[model samples]
Target chain A: MLSVHRNHPWQAFDKLMRNSMNLGRDLDRMFLNPLTRQRDSFAGWPQFNLWTNDDEIIVTAEVPGLEADQIDVDINNNQLTVSATVEAPELAEGESYQRRERFSGSFERTLRLPFAVDQEKSEARYVDGVLEIRLSKPERDKPRKLSVKAG
Target chain B: MNNSTDLKTTNPPSHELQKQESPTPEGAEPTRETRLYRPHVDILDSADKVTLRVNLPGVNEERTDLTLEKNILTIRGHIDPPHYEGFELVYGEYGVGDFERSFQLTNEIDREGIQASVRNGILTVELPKVKQASKQKITVAAG
Candidate 1:
């Protein structure tokens, strides 16, 4: 399912104002950002889905032809990040590509969760080129069923 | 390898392009067939064979169809949509849909020797060159 970004109408203007104030500093940061880590702009490669429930949050990404060791997933301060690279296979001598559309590059996506999660308890599995990560909500975050006494 | 052999990448028609090409027929259901997506494909033609690699995540052997008839080769594959119980989507980048691509085979291809396989959601199709065409050698006479 694809959705339009639900950003507040004023958010863009707000960002513009802030960016103008720190233009020089931001330029330096931008130059350094790509050297260290490249971040996705909401919609990026190997598109993923984020799901939330009462007990857990699930994130799934479609990354075909990638080995498990190539992917790195981490969560810190309620933000989950997934990073991976899709490398194009080396071609043999005298072999040239006729059609090249598949992407081959590194990508990183990060999202903040509404509730705290137990990172240690989370489980991840890659099946048929899809990576699914299940992040369980902390014990304190789980909803409690309340019992009512006869009134 | 002959550098003169023409190699072209054909792009599938987008909605706007399709609309420009021809008018939609009357009583045609737009919603039913609006989801036609073109899978990214790469084709490599060597002296002896042509190799095609298509990115088809979540597609397996059971859900894919490959056929060649009358010099038209077609690839059709379906990917099962992922569903989460009681889950509201927070962010999504790609939509889950079926993919279809077709190619017009040339006379140089050995239609009988086509082979296909799927691994890690990557489909590789091999089309061998016709022996007679690749083996033809022009002899130069000394005057």
Candidate 2:
């Protein structure tokens, strides 16, 4: 006759060890992952949104504390590049920084357009720290209306 | 009787002296008020020019201040904080910190043509490039 239930001490110990190791791994990933990752030069790139309208493609980027002249916009070979250098904040004389969170440096972002753009017709405007770029799509890529005969 | 006399000779309440030195506004009832602080910031290039943006939440465009002194740019503004009397805040989360940020300009910025504007909660500063620093076309002479 076999016992209805059996208690295994080794099984309980093994489960406890597995749970402890899993917790340790989770903590290591949470704390060390970001510190060990390699960051790009343009790590603090501003958030931007790109969308297309009927005849133009619009790109909006959040570039706080930057002037219009500080930014350079170049379009070449169907790609648009936006580059700018932001100077770091100056510390006061004999003042030691306690906590610094703001980021400052040169950054560049290149975006490829879905359709070829008319480089000459592109326009950029900066308002309220937001940069808006409007690029007119090439004439051939624009949608054309076709006439249909009613049968 | 001697103990009571010694207690009276002790230092007067400090609150009384403060009240006398700075009297409250005449006919203005004291009300608890809160104010939000938002810092102004500027972005500039290697040249010492000012490019500023002020984050002024719940503040009108007319109430903000933007100033530039030599190579330093300062932005100052105020926002009305929330008001809730007799309400205990449980699990409160949102509050705005006062804003005060300054930037030192470099020599390349054109200080004369700095432009600024504020709309919504964002302030934008435009620092024009100096004429000599801009890329210019060099003409070739025929040999």
Models, CA RMSD each: 16.0, 27.1
Candidate 1 residue runs with Cα over 4 Å from true position: A1-43, A145-151, B1-34, B132-143
Return the TM-score for each candidate structure.
0.69, 0.40
Instruction: Give the per-residue lDDT of model 2 (tens digit) for A1-151.
Output: 1232245546766878999977754543332232333222452254345666556677766565566778899987478889876443443333222222233455687877666788888999875445778788778777888899899
lDDT (Cα, tens digit) per residue for candidate 2, span B62-115 = 756668998887665554443334323232223433344456656666788878
Error of 2 at B128 (Å): 30
lDDT of 1 by residue, B31-135 (tens): 443244577776776778889988777788887899888999988777667777689888775566667778898998988899999877788999998886567
TM-score, candidate 1, is: 0.69
Alpha-carbon shift of residue A143 in model 1 (angstroms): 2.9
What local lDDT does model 2 show for residue B83? Answer: 36
Q: Which stretches of candidate 2 lie over 4 Å from their true place?
A: A1-40, A146-151, B1-143
